[model samples]
Target chain A: MSIDTSTAARVAKLARIKVEDDALPGLAEDFNRILGFIEELNEVDVEGVEPMVSVEPMRLKRRVDGVTDGNQQDKILSNAPDAREGFFAVPKVVE
Target chain B: MSDLTKLTIAEARDALRKGETTSAALTEACLAAIEGAGALNAFVHHTPEIARAQAQAADARIKAGDAPALCGIPLGIKDLFCTKGVPSQAASRILEGFKPEYESTVSSQLFERGAVMLGKLNMDEFAMGSSNETSVYGNAVNPWKRGNDEAELTPGGSSGGSAAAVAADLCLGATGTDTGGSIRQPAAFTGITGIKPTYGRCSRWGIVAFASSLDQAGPMTKDVRDAAIMLEAMCGHDPKDSTSADLPVPDFEAMLTGDIRGKTIGIPREYRMEGMPEEIETLWAEGRKMLEDAGAKIVDISLPHTKYALPTYYVIAPAEASSNLARYDGVRYGHRATLAQGDGITEMYEKTRAEGFGNEVKRRVMIGTYVLSAGFYDAYYNRARKVRTLIKRDFEEVFAQGVDAILTPATPSSAFPLGMEMDDPVQMYLNDVFTVTVNLAGLPGIAVPTGTDKHGLPMGLQLIGRPWEEGDLLNTAYALEQAAGFVSKPAKWW
Candidate 1:
């Protein structure tokens, strides 16, 4: 129920947020505090209760699986930090 | 001409239709006010050119006799909304300079109805914090001071800037999305009216996702009627958001009859927390009496899981946030970290996020990531969802018993001075205690300014209504507004 420095580091990595070595303890403490607060949920008797996926009682609406809109690769890449040749350019993933 | 910015949406609409005022004049007045109120930091982006053009278009629409309800009204948009070409940062550094290519569905709907946008307002970064202090633009100073004291008070958060803007008359109203009391808490803090409609009442198409299930968009306005008017224009079923209900958006403005005679109002016993401010308690009692005076049958009720709403919110919101924010990886839009010689994509995401997110955001993302992790998923995320169901059932039970609305103190206390609880996140989280249950249950809730604390700061009373019953909720609040007759505006310090 409590997160230690190593756990915090693991979580930060999983979240893709960089928490340096020195900051992990502090991050752990923050995590512990939040988790401690959230531990109150364990008191509830949730036997046979369905985890709510939607607030309203409605089945997810379905639409015909077709391309409703597209054909604007330029617009899609407009805000990219690096877009080249009509594609999003990232640091070389395949070396 | 003197104070067109101060006019409520209804008044502005009436004046415009009577040919007594033009949208251009209203826009100019609001723009001038916004320019002058720089001290409040309510408006982070000033769009006078866009406002003028929209106002001009609105004038043409009005002249053509095709004006909608929001025609010619100027309003401030929360930074969370992806306003096309406007800097919609959600008050975060990560999104610095990111002008969204597409408009958020709610905002586009408003614009389509001829609502003019003054600019983007400040908020907690990604709508994460209870105090506006977490905003990258610095805290939006509360226009209301502590009874003529010089120290600045917080306008409450996530929707703090929206509240402050409406309170200071910088804009007639502003859009606010409440994940956990972001709208109602700030609205209470700033003595304005805010309503978070039922979860699916408004589409979430272009809103920067916070807690997907919990985040519902609503209007923060000067009064109950204005809140009603703006909420109507802001809501519709959008096919783009599958969660959006196909149910019709009722004429919320027309439903404000202010006659709640024979309406059953519940006073939830669970909301009366220990250590609650005497002022808030008295305010709640006064609210009960006022509703009673309006012929509402007041009954005591119990929502047993009320105490757990905040805990559930913290878990679910951040868990969803961690996932939603994953899209901000370096490859796409938003701030990308400057890399060192040997760095790769992982390094880029880490550094970008580490530098980009504020401390509160980082903490939340960490918590969210932790809860959804392998070992803890069932213990945390799944458990919170079940508690959420219980919390929701509490409301359903009350409503099934013919309880039309539930009234409680909007906040634990009036707006506190800025920086009072910055060190303690738990203390700050308590601000949403009264408001979060509505979000957990996906019910319509509104905060109506009802009274003032001893320090003369405004205090509000909240009314929780049935699901998709914003019109009824607004009407109940309208009755409270009539009874309380709270007309005190914060003395303009900024």
Candidate 2:
């Protein structure tokens, strides 16, 4: 499917990445080209073929729900751009 | 000592064992070489203090007679793997100044085996680009120039820096991750050896996520045996990464017997694409002949779905990338955009990603988001998944027919000029044509430098092995490496 500037703008919004109006056209063009290339897969007849969920055929390992490791609050917050009072700080959401 | 930095891992291991050379001397030699080779820009971070400390510890271990195979060997790590307290940016602005509090499993495994870290290597931003040009630290230049043209060429990506570091002898070996030809392509371009083992072979925990299913850490080294040595150390089961296989990793180096008598090697006719460079074609033929002379039977085969592999990879990788990258939203770590007076969290995330990611990464995120969007999910994402199954099936059919391995050219051409294919993204994507199918099929593949093009740039041939049979694949490559006798170096252009 061809993606236009408006659709590209919508996708940018969905992706939470800001794209200016002028850049939308270029972004749309890139999307169109990539999608155009990907469109080649349409020729393949996938009738009765199963989608590959995993490359290897192994059962997913499960464990009893339990906390394996934690409590290093200082280390976890060391790299935060903004940390306050043992928590990651963000723009206030509640009034 | 005649340049201790030039010794291979095997040679260095022997010397260390025999008390002929110390790890401290080897580490100092590598650090000095890295200091002088700034022109290539392969290393993005230098860890001399860490290297020296690790070397001292390794020397002590050797004295106690408790050394591992990689004891005291210096190696470069691609910026993609997170090393504790080191800047691990994945060659993107998004992760600027982001040092991890913990180490990636692969890096930690290497360290535990007594490997020394020389520094972090550069790569395409988020491992998204085929050439190293998209790296934030700038292109990692290929040490091999085309017959003294003096124009900088690319060490292929997204493991370009790893390839460059190993090829230039700046380090004995380096770690590389492949999603779709990242390791093998760069290895081919730089005239080194790289292998991408079967999916689930290496633990994915602590590595910056790319395409999760396709991404795997491997070794880029001066030769096939080094590749085997480093790969064995790099692979193991991690409870943290559920996808990591529980089976034991074999002694890959010990399996390099270089004997392929009565083995069957498949030459996929489908890989003989239109407009393939005559040099690459000749190299493939020579590889087949070498295998035959080593007492193997060569047969023409067809992987009909080969052409669709790239397109399928593009779809699936991006879709996964979009989901994987969602976590980098100006959160606990990494670059966060400055906000205005009334800016909310939404605005913060939008601005942060837009300013943080490079053009290629942005384009990929956009394409990935679009394909997985509501109206197109089935048409794009699901369709690609089905196509992926067929691609995998094609390899299974061939292997099931008793084909032990497949031989093909590693890349379509030798290293091109730095900015050659920037204008067309599709053209850049075409570089992985011969190598991506192996990733899609979840099989081990290695690129061994076998010959050179007319311009004196090294070209390589790839060997595709059966599932979970990296030992056999490496052995076949060992045989080819012995027969080809490719001893040419890049002539110290840097």
Candidate 3:
């Protein structure tokens, strides 16, 4: 499908990235090219093929279910721009 | 100390063991090298005092006969990995000042083995670009040169700085994460050796998630053996990473037999597409000839689903990435923007995220969100996943037919000009076509320098091995590396 400027704008909003109104055309063009490239896959026939989870056929290794964090909360929060009461502080959302 | 900057981790360790060099001396050498190469833009941050203190501790440990394999070995941690007390922005304005209290599992593992941190290396914003040009911190220059024009060739990202630093002798070895040729391509571009072990080989606990299912941490180094040594240290079971395997870690170094006698190496017929440069084809042919001369059998195989790999990866990776990066909203961990006049909190959120992430990152996030959206989920994401399965199955069938490993070009072409992709997203994505499938199949692959192209730019040969068979993969790469006899040194140190 041809990606229009409006579609491009929606994509940008969905992606949570800001793009100027004038740049939407370029974004739309880029998206169309990517989609065009993706369309090339439709020609390949994968009838009985099973999707590969890994190069090796071994099952994923399982670990014991446990709840232990690295416990460096203060160190982790050290770089926060806004912190309050030992948590990341943010602008209030509710009245 | 015999110009410690040029020493490999193995050489440094031997020197330390024999009391010929101290960790302090090694660390100082690296720090001096970093200072000397300041214009290369290889580092995001440096901690000389911490490095010196760590080096002293390593010396004390050596004196007490308590040294681990990596004790005192100075290495660069990619800025993408979280390092306690150090800013760990994935080279984006979104994470401009973000730091983590805990070190990433791979980094911490290296530290436990006593590797001294030289500093965090630079990368593309959120590991998004092929060239380090996407980095908010500026691009890393290719250590190698063409003429007097040091117009700063790309070091290849998002692990560009890691590859450049190791190649430039700024660090003995460096950590790199490969999601889709990130590590291998850069390694190839910079004339270094890098391996992306089978997915889940290294825990991804604290590393910033890129494409969680495909993201894996590995080592970038001057030689295959050093890569092996670092890989050995980096692999282990970590309960914290749900996807991390609990399998026994093998002694990768011990398995480097250097003898590929009678091994069957598959040369995928599909990899040599029409547009591949003649020089790269020649190099691939030369690599196959070298392995055959070493008594290995060569057979032509087909990965029929090869063409679908790039598209499948583009869809799956972005789909997962969008979900994984959702946690980075301004309220929790990254930059926040203020609402404009007449806008409210929701608008504030919209503004913060839009302003925070870079263009490529935003593109991926949007692609991901679109594919995962209710209406398109089946048509895009699900279909891509099915194709991914087919790609994986193709490798499985080939390996099942007595092929010990597969050999192909790491990339279709050599490093393009720095700004070549700024106006062309398709061209940029094509750069990863050759390397993305291995990740999709969750197989181990390594990129070794094959030879230089006509333009004198370096090209690489990628070796794909069966799942968890990194040892065999490295062994073949080591043999080819020895036979190719392509020793490359970057242009004169700035």
Highest DockQ against the true fold, candidate: 2
Model 2, B1-494: lDDT tens digits are 67898999999999999999999999999999999899999999999999999999999999999989999999999999999999999999999989999999999999999999999999999999888999999999999999968899999999999999999899999999999999999999999999999999999998999899899999999999998999999998999999999999999999999999989999999999999988888899999999999999999998999999999999999999999999888888999999999998899999999999999988888788988999889998999999999999999999989999999999999999999999889999999998899888889999999998888999999999998999999999999999999988998967
RMSD of each: 1.0, 0.8, 2.1
Full ranking by DockQ: 2, 1, 3
TM-score of chain A of 2: 0.93
CA shift of B324, model 2, Å: 0.4
Which candidate, 1 or 3, would have the higher DockQ against the true structure?
1
DockQ for all candidate structures vs. native: 0.83, 0.88, 0.51
List where candidate 3 sits over 4 angstroms from the true fold.
A46-77, A92-95
Q: Is candidate 2 or candidate 3 better by DockQ?
A: 2
| lDDT sort, best first | 2, 1, 3
Off by over 4 Å in 2: none
Tens digits of lDDT, candidate 3, B260-289: 999999999989888788888899999999
lDDT of each: 0.91, 0.93, 0.86
Q: In candidate 1, what are the lDDT values of residues A1-92, reduced to their tens digit?
A: 66788888888999999988998887788777777888888889999999989888998889999988998887788888888999987776
Error of 1 at B345 (Å): 1.2
**How do the residues B397-429 of candidate 1 rate in per-residue lDDT, one tens digit apiece?**
999999999999889989888989988888889
Task: For model 2 chain B, give the 10-residue run with minimal summed lDDT.
Answer: B361-370
